[model samples]
Target chain A: MTNLTLALDAMGGDHGPHITVPATLQALRLSSFLHIILVGNEAEITPYLSQIETSVRSRIEILHTTEVVSMSDRPVHALRNRKQSSMRLAIELVRDGKADACLSAGNTGALMAMSKVLLKTLPGIDRPALVSCLPAVNKTPVYLLDLGANVSCCSETLFQFAVMGSVLCEAVDKNPSPKVALLNVGIEEIKGNDQVQQAGQLLQQSPQLNYVGFIEGNDLFSGNVDVIVCDGFVGNITLKTSEGIARLLVHQLEKGLQQGFFVRLMAKLIAPRINSVLNQMNPDHYNGASLIGLRGIVVKSHGSADESAYLQAINLAVTEAQRRLPQMIEERLESILLDINS
Target chain B: MTNLTLALDAMGGDHGPHITVPATLQALRLSSFLHIILVGNEAEITPYLSQIETSVRSRIEILHTTEVVSMSDRPVHALRNRKQSSMRLAIELVRDGKADACLSAGNTGALMAMSKVLLKTLPGIDRPALVSCLPAVNKTPVYLLDLGANVSCCSETLFQFAVMGSVLCEAVDKNPSPKVALLNVGIEEIKGNDQVQQAGQLLQQSPQLNYVGFIEGNDLFSGNVDVIVCDGFVGNITLKTSEGIARLLVHQLEKGLQQGFFVRLMAKLIAPRINSVLNQMNPDHYNGASLIGLRGIVVKSHGSADESAYLQAINLAVTEAQRRLPQMIEERLESILLDINS
Candidate 1:
């Protein structure tokens, strides 16, 4: 009976419909006002329908699409050839206003390509950015923009990305005055290269952003700034490196503790504290990065994402939909681009 | 009495004499074949002399220099104006054959400028690279070159750097057939722009280098390779960023442990393990990056270095002096530059 419909690309991710169906059911249970639109082959979805309760069945609906896009498939080719891809169909649901947002764990490039091709950029958006949440000091998540969304970037693009990132932090993070920083080599303003230096000056001069000065990678988890801006290439490397190291630390901890009984006892005593630390750093709790500056909603998930990650993605879309995030981005960014154009 | 003499710049770091003097003494104690050359104001050196025992005093010498280069002073300006800076004095000692190699905790730019102007480059050396060791998986260090020795770099420079870095690793890390990787955005030989791709081909075809493959920032710690080669801009950024993050993580851990009873208990139990982890990650433990291809030897510390850090620097210089590392680099890299020119 409610109008908040979310389109899910059920055929995507490692778990596919096997985990997708139940996760979708679990998400729908959280909101009585929620509606679910599943995008994939109807034949594949049909076999799993009997598993869900009759009440949950009414809240879920299917939109049939025949083609599947494998993770390794070329993005441009897949978009050009497969009009019936579940990812495309899911995005179409948002474009046509049948669903509020599309959440996909499909091939990231294809999702981005299709979203750009189908939904188009929001008015005044130079480029759409991928925004993700990172663990900050107090267990709160700060938004980092262009997280592998684009590799090569210009000063103008980064300047604009900063404005868009600030808008999202305000819209979603709810910090009325979101502190913004450009990632740099050092704390000293002049230490970064020409591009970062120029962007720093622009952000500082602009009334649109708080322009919290430069932040090194260390400051990302320090909670000193609410939003961190960088081109996608640097952003991608930072994100993956931190994740890899954190996982490596956890692995080392587990292995090191298992070597002796005394070490194991010590681990057991400290298990809760370690759990708290790990939970504070968990990516799942934060869930879903918004594709900022997109006209309509599209959330990309890790290609190897599981049911828990998809559920997080679904929640992210619903939150953004209810909050009307992109519309706010478009409005906030209008003056900045107009000034540049003029 | 040992003929081996190392010229330590006493007035270099943010902390200056405090860190410098102690580190010199520590180095002298650890290494039997070392004569410490303390370069700074005689007034400053005479006071620290009281701390050294009479027997050790016989091995220590001071080259009186009045002026120290402040961090704010420009590189070329410091080199021209501060005629008595420890960095300049140290380099002079090496050139005059009074010392084997120069070690400093001074301004990096000033040291680079002074070393290039005075010590000059080895024959066929296009550019001298600052190469240092970073953590690899097995708790051993890998050599990463051009770590702020040059800001702007070309394909030929990087190709030459790989050869220099391989020899430096062999001499210092003792890793024969050290796997050299060109740092890039991706592993694809064609992933980066033309310069990186061209260098990739040259490195792969290089018989002198192990030439393992392309490496990203994440791969630096993986121990998959022993020598990482990149432009100075990227290398400098990577080194600083890693150091900044390690410091930030320690701060976070301290806060998490010392604040409450649960945290204190957790800290007490894991204190030994954390110390081991941190000791393995300390910048001081892997201190002293080499300015390779210089006509003589020069080593620069992190600008904010302390006494322990300076001692690490002195220890590194003694190692380089004993190995006669500069002679090895000069002999090894002569033909690599020829290949580039041809």
Candidate 2:
């Protein structure tokens, strides 16, 4: 494996450098073959960098940027004006081939728009999708794609997502033939809107992909399929909705535990086991969402991610970079498109 | 407070007469003014009726219908051909004014189609919507609408849903000036597709509705809004996604509790309290999604609902009947439309 370099957007996310700097340092210690370029204000990032030893610090380089993309900054406005922003600069590093991948816990829309403008989509791919691994019942997690990247998608774009998702799943998960499904309201034929219906038809006829047909929202966690494809509008809602329900249930359980003395005692005894299990299933732990179909790798971490979660995002970027995901997608897509065209 | 009569599809749902009969008896026992017309084959429904005494059985009438709408039956096919089916007959009873409302745990699409064709929409309503109560942090449950009733809803249809949802929430939940929100990918003014964006603008302009702007999927259970409106496609996915996540979490928690001896013992000790708390928040307990905007009240229960859940659906039917939801919507829509037009 070659040495992989990741550009970290140090001034991204709600906690900014406070979370990103520590996560970067932790990531550096974990990966011997990994180098990180911290992109943010020099003074703010320098304080966190000073404590590390000179040899370890040798792998870490600070690429200072004066501007930071605020979470609320509109994507178009940011793209037009904030070129030197840490998020854009980090993506620029990937575009300029200075870094194998870029990691940011930042504004998803801005990052996506900037990455699209700079890195560009691979040949035969109309739009890049934000793909992430979701915890499922099976040992291997399920991949769900286009998570708020494109709010609306036509049939061709959705088809492209299905192909890209399959390639990524097969490469990353090491599954030879990954089963892919389109996310719809119902699993039955003649279900879903025009876009989904047409996409289903396209997926069904694809010889190069293992298309398993439609899956309902309830079946998402069943792990019945390796890749679940949808437009950004639905995918984003599904992801966020899952997070909401998980939080609500956990909150309810904690409240229930506080009511009675014996119950509270029982809860205390079982808390460790429960937390371990829950923390594994927690969406917060699932850190990075890859901006797939792009010419270069760009990993977007949750803007609200903590140090541990941000580190997980950095780890994900390293893994994708090591695997050469974009190249694999580019290779697989050529055959898939040839089959479709034929 | 007049005697409320409901038509139940006895042969509908997974368990058929087994669940419906007991749930019917229990409902009759609880409500002194309630009368039920169990519509199904005489042979199938009579066996259950024989066990009950004459006094309770007097409130129950068996309307023999040889045909039954199977779960997988297509909506249009069932509506066109299975007019004599138990599900269709139950809905027909409401249209004929033989029953005040109808309850079915049969095919949702079939029920919606039949209800729309027979009972018809209110004077000003373009289409009907499926509205259900979802558990939230607040004392009152959140009302989410258009749950797969209209797969693709125009802005006008969405605007109508907002008005209808507000009326239904006010009438049934008894909450004055209920806060309404449109479900979208993001809360920002610029965040959604054309349909949702236009709907938001329409909602914001409506003086009759207490529009609270856009809400993401994660906030569906926040209890901050009384009514959440979306196209049937998005709403159906959101509701099912929540169900899927809830089931996954509960399954994981149970599996976790079964691990070690000490943990298992603690689980047993705290199981009762835990179950009680979980039960209150459980989506299964929240039965009976009302098909609103129609001239009659029709509540669709989960096809897999048990006796208790089935009874909850019947109770919902009685409540909607008592409140006269259609009448309220009709009155409210007239005023709302007047405001919009002026």
Candidate 3:
């Protein structure tokens, strides 16, 4: 908790201000040194701000804009048309050094598009990737990257993703020299496609990286690796598939728990613990996915995220901003590239 | 069980005859008319066969093969050498019309290669794909295909998978005109890569096939469609990822259930119900995957499957054999291709 000011897209996400406004107030209350600038339509966002007390309200600032990026809007359209949109303005604040970070629960493609253009990618990085932490068995979260930023990636792009993922993991998790792994169909050398195989070669040659060999999808939560990298197509599907499984299991278990009178009654007694377990299993609970490799911090919340999940996104932004993640990545990449060249 | 004989590669999986033999006996007990030809080393196979009673023992036969395919062996290696391997011989039984179907829990690559070469793909089909039923919210399972059979599939290859998946789903699940979908990163038209988009176009044009549009990974268990198709790479990762999540949730819940005395006592009271729910969630319990598009039936069990899981695989092979899946696919594809050509 270092003192920092962050920008929030209050007009983004499914519920927009309904979820983001409350989450913003909650964040301000929790962090005494933190300040947030809410970007959205003035009339829609002002009502949520009215309930806050004067002392706490002093830390909140609202930058009014009329336009908003809908979920269905194409990335290219959003970039060209929506200059005053809440999502765009939030990232612009970070780009202009008016805020330390940008957090948005908006169209993922649009958010990435705006963030990359405005905040710009860090030097030596070709593109920014979406990185998210997934719950793992060993109490620590596993960082998975390129969650649908670039659908199909080349070998060099995948290599860049690994470098960004490793830097972000080390900076945020406070684990130096974090073990990185490439996600593939099998653990064997000849398992994945050409892109994955070529990337593996690049990683293996980099002595600067703690590059473990291949990891399959089943080991996503095995807690044996710190960072797992793949192209966006596979990564997106893997993340979403895990979410679907979580929902299915929870729904099935709850249905089964309601069967007999005694079992139902017993279920009530352990409802709290069961709910906690379900929450941990739910990927929605881990809401923030950083658009890494950009010059400034940008955290993307799930489009359907509720107030609590939105709050987690804000907290993630705070953490990343405080740690100066972009700077660390810049320094790390510079040295790694130099070493490879030598 | 319509008095069908299945060739079993008893020496294939991690446990070899130890798990497969007990599973075969269990399958025999469940289906009185079903007979199994256990193909493996005579010395190792005879010991398990000796313990069975006289009446049930009549249903079992041993086909000795000393060479067994190791899990690490490549597909080309197994196809070139290891001709007398249990996996190869089991598939040969189906090719020679000695058995109705072939089932193995052996090295997947070897099994597919051997099955494709010996049994051969259907007339219009270029290759065989691995199709497995995944647990959905509805009682009926969803069929997902191309599970690591061909790593990176082309548009035409993906189209073939959809046709094969539809045929198998209709025959095995007994649902006529099953809703077929292509698995993609998004449901939108502009979402996936070239192969997926082109496949979508082909599926849309096929009026004979019940081709529903795209499905995202989160909808895998939604039970909205009967058949979901993807390349081997994505399908394999999705299947294994869900399995990993199931284990994580079950482990987390069990750990939670063991906490307090009162809650622990109640957990024991409902332990049976809880176990049943966990079993349904676990993918291994739904253990059989069909190697479809071949001229003969072939079912694949998990490599580390236990007795119960392996038994499910045997049951699956029996069902496919009884339904004459390959014949159904051949007839269906003939008419569909004729319709498309016209």
Candidate 4:
């Protein structure tokens, strides 16, 4: 495979350069054909870069910037004043064809706004959605889109999300024909608001897409469908709620183990097996959420991501870059629009 | 406490009388002042009743009904054709003042339809909402409403839900001036749809309610707020998704335990502790969901609830009945409406 270059937002997330620099180096070690352009203030990033080995240092370069976008900065404010910020500069690299993709763990709203204004949406796409893969019982991850991009979506926008999500699974996950379902309260035809119901109708009519009708939040991890589509409002809530429940379970299990001597001894014996399962279910295991539907690739890592989790985000950028995901989505969307117009 | 009579739809749920009968008897054993009028096919219910001890037989009565509401029956169809159905008869008893409260594990749509038509909504309520309590990490249960009643809700409807939910926690859960919050994609004022944003504004302006602004889905189980309000569409999806995640965690943990001989042995040793923790997190532990905003009390159990879970539903009904929940909601709503108008 040819080397894919990524623009790393070094001054992003909570720990910024401290987390991003090591994660970038670790990702470079894993993939021989990978390069990154670290974009951040030189003073903050240089100290971390100096720790890298001399041989690997050639594969990395720093694009110094003066401004930083704090977590609390508003998207509009960031766009107007922080044009030279690390987050914007990294996305600018993608727009300039200097990088295969860009990755950030910065303010999600600002990152999305900067990416959209700089790279622009692809043809036939209404809005770019935050797409992420959630692990399912079937051991194959299900792709969920519009995590928190567009809070209020029209029927046409949701229909577009389903198409984009399907393309994502097909391109990155390598599913030949991904099964897509609209997330609703119930599976019945008469369920949900007009936006969701109308979207389901449009999906069913599309011959190119494998539309599986409606699915509830409970069906998210059941792994029955490859792509689950919903507006950002419902998608964001569902994703966060799932993470909360997972944490509750682990907390309860640990509390249970601390009850008695026999239980503690037994828990110690099976600790390895239990830890493996917990790690798999950990939200960190699936940290990166792609900002799909844009002309250029932009993957958003969690703001609180550690080095390992940040590396997972880099891996996502690498995989999507290698597969030429944005180009594939553009092609699929054009054919879909042609099919609809015909 | 004065004896509270409960009209139970024994024919409701998948297992019908098999689960409801034993659950009723168990509930009777726990509460000396509790009385149940079983509404279902006499033949099926009589067999289970005959097993009850002669001493407690006086507390139980059979109100035989020939018709039944199947899970697949449409709400409109059930209301038109099945007036004499077990589900309807149980609700009718509440309307006729023969029972203090009614409980049904039947078709959710049918139960809501019949209850609304029979009991009617409270004077100021626009619509009746399905309210249920969810277990939180703090070991306190948070009351959530509109679980699947009003699919599309206006800001006023959601504002009413907050009022009704607060009254519920106060009356049944004994939370004085419960902290109420609107469930949204994010806690920020600028986030979420117009309806949620408008509802938040309304909530903040109201002095009668302890409105705590917006909360995300992750906060549902965080135990930070006493009442979480949202439209039925979002609420139902969030509730079901939490149940699904809890189930997935248990399934994965068990699978991990079965990996090797040593692990299996260790799992066996810690089985009791694990089971205790799982039971607490089980949906069964929190099975009862009350239909709030109505003039009369109506509780809906899970359609697949077993005897133990059904008992939880019965417990909810008894508690609400003893506390005079309907009366409390009516009074609180009146004062709030007066506050608004003033």
Candidate with the greatest TM-score versus the true structure: 2
Q: State which docking tier applies to candidate 2.
A: medium
Against the true structure, candidate 1 reaches a TM-score of 0.90
- For candidate 1, write residues B108-166 as lDDT tens digits: 77788889998988776788899887643246677888777786578878887888888
After superposing candidate 1, which stretches have Cα over 4 Å from the reference?
A: A43-47, A282-287, A338-342, B121-127, B135-137, B145-154, B188-195, B216-219, B254-270, B282-286, B335-342
For candidate 3, give the lDDT of residue B186. 89
Chain B TM-scores of the candidates: 0.93, 0.97, 0.96, 0.97
- Candidate 4: regions farther than 4 A off: A135-138
- List the TM-score for candidate 1's chain B: 0.93
What is residue A279's positional error in candidate 2, in angstroms? 1.3
Per-residue C-alpha lDDT of model 1 across residues A50-167, encoded as one tens digit per residue: 8677778999999988898887766688789879989899999999999999888777667877888899998767778888876443556677777766765678788888898788
Task: Give lDDT tens digits, candidate 3, residues B1-342.
Answer: 357899999998889999999998888888889888999998998888776787789988899889989988998999999999999999999999899999999999889999999998998899899999875446787889989998899998899899988988888778888999998888889888899999999888899899989999889988899999998888998989988888888889999999999879889988998999997786666788999999999999998999988998888888888888999999998988888878
Assess the local accuracy of residue A30 in candidate 4 as a C-alpha lDDT between 0 and 100. 84
When 1 and 4 are scored with DockQ, the better candidate is 4
lDDT of 4 by residue, B32-125 (tens): 8888999999999888776577657889999988899988888899999998999999999999999999999999999999999999999999
Q: Which ten residues in a row have the lowest lDDT in candidate 3 chain A?
A: A132-141
